[model samples]
Target: MGGFFTPDPPPPSPPPPPVIVTDPEAEAAQARQDAIARNRRGLAGTIATSETGLLQPSQGVGKSLLGE
Candidate 1:
């Protein structure tokens, strides 16, 4: 009988593993571009912070360099 004598069907075979290919030269170029962009952003941030500080009022604005 199907219920008593039939052996269970073998488990379905696992799916084949995926293959990935990469270009080392392209990857290195991309990394270099990213680093350059990061540096630009850091410089921009520093400039922005300095500009913002200059625009804000501070107690030291009128004070002399000699503490007069």
Candidate 2:
């Protein structure tokens, strides 16, 4: 068989290098501050509904039966 007709194997690739950071604590503190600011902007308060003006027809009968 001719060398030109034979298939050639591919070359090996180099491994990836590790990453090094200078300030890990500073990065964590900044992330916490961002989360707190986001939460404050989306916060909401609940409102209570009043029923003082609404009347029920059975209230008088129920009170008389119970001697209230």
- Candidate 1 structure quality by residue, lDDT tens digits, 7-50: 87778899999988899999999999998888887755556566
Off by over 4 Å in 1: 1-5, 43-68
- Candidate 2 residue pairs in backbone clash: none
Positional deviation of residue 30's Cα in model 1 after best superposition, in angstroms: 1.3
- The clash numbers for all candidates, in the given order, read 0, 0
Best by TM-score: 1
Q: Write the per-residue lDDT of candidate 2 for residues 12-33, one digit (tens) a residue.
A: 7887887877698999999999
| Worst 10 contiguous positions by lDDT, candidate 1 | 43-52
Clashes by residue pair, model 1: none
All candidates' TM-scores?
0.50, 0.35
